[model samples]
Target: MSTMPTLDTPVTLTISPDGGIDGRSRRYEKFLGDMAGVYRDAEAWQAAVSARGADELVYWVDDHRYQEGPGALIVGTSTLLPGRIGDEFAVTRGHLHAIADRAELYHCLSGHGVMLLETVDGQSMAVELTPGKAVNVPGHWIHRSVNVGDEPFVTLFCYAADAGQDYALIADAGGMKSLVVADGDGWMLTPNPDHTGYRKA
Candidate 1:
């Protein structure tokens, strides 16, 4: 009599022992096709970005991730235009809103500037910032900066997070808007509105 297979010793067989190998291999081929499609899409995206010069020479740095949860993303742009002896630019200032996962940090790569930090209890202080210097803006603190130099100033800014996240909500705050600058006309605040090249010129 023929013996039946038991759980400890089961028989291994294919869908069809004769010629079903091609069909089995087709599934793997489809998976490879899907992966190739993803790679093509990524390559196309990089090409388009390169054509527009959107990611040109720029100082960009940020934390890898937050210790507790999500992290933060910080981005800054600087230009070296012709400037007089006392020309100043108010970059940004005011209440540091709490991010979901990360904190913010700033590193002054070039030029001279000042970071005015105010605590929740109404105490404020100005910290001098220079190239190669780094500052950590704690969660929920208010801060701002001013360029106090004669030449073109450059800065590198960054953000940290409890998790890997981007914290840009402060860009939408009311009092936090504008950079109060020490121009020839004394302290002047300018609206920090998002500008497009087509709209301005």
Candidate 2:
């Protein structure tokens, strides 16, 4: 079973006004309360990162089980380093397992890239993404992104589902396969019986 990260504990703060406080002082007190809330939220986010570790941004769960089952929200951000000359990652055609929920969304935080998206029925499309652009991956659709520019690719990923459920799972086409490695010469692709084909970059 995959070890899931624990949710951050909540923090609460309360402020009481004094009977003799002036209007400006009251306003300042309110501002302090607001700042406290912001600090609490940031602390919670940091705790989550500490529990999950920084590597979750790039760790690929190649061939793993969805221990949380289905329908859970998993929010994360990821950054991909620049590929060496002639380096490539071949992506296989597959569908996300969480079909009952809304589609997964990816917002590009920086860099330039293209994502190949295909329907379960074989229709294909490509989306060009740059900084500040967002793309929604329809549930059960086959999609993969490739960095086509010189810089490292960065993105904010949001997967929505019920608590304690798997955020996403890849369903491979009949025979399609993919390889992600540092060496450019190690990748290859093949045709799948389910009407999808894989290619190496």
Q: Name the candidate that leads on TM-score.
A: 2
TM-score to native of every candidate shown: 0.40, 0.45
Q: Give the 10-residue window scoring lowest on summed lDDT in candidate 1.
A: 28-37
What alpha-carbon RMSD in Å does predicted model 2 have with respect to the real structure? 18.0
Return the TM-score for candidate 2, rounded to 2 decimals: 0.45
What C-alpha lDDT does candidate 2 achieve relative to the native structure? 0.42
Q: After superposition, how far is residue 70 of candidate 1 from its true place, in Å?
A: 1.4
**Residue-by-residue lDDT tens digits, candidate 1, 1-201:** 999743332223233211122112122111111211111133543453456343332121121221233333424333222122123342332335454324567666666666765443434566676677878876555665555554434544455423233223333332333334565734454443431111100
- Per-candidate Cα lDDT values, in order, are 0.40, 0.42
Residue 162, candidate 2: Cα error in Å is 5.7
Candidate 2 lDDT tens digits, 1-201: 899877644333221111111111111111111211111133643454466453433212111112233544445444444432223332222334334334767777777655656554445666777887989886645556555556656555556533222212332233323323233433323223343342211
TM-score of candidate 1 to 2 decimals = 0.40
Please give the distance, in angstroms, between residue 177's alpha carbon in candidate 2 and its true position after superposition. Answer: 11
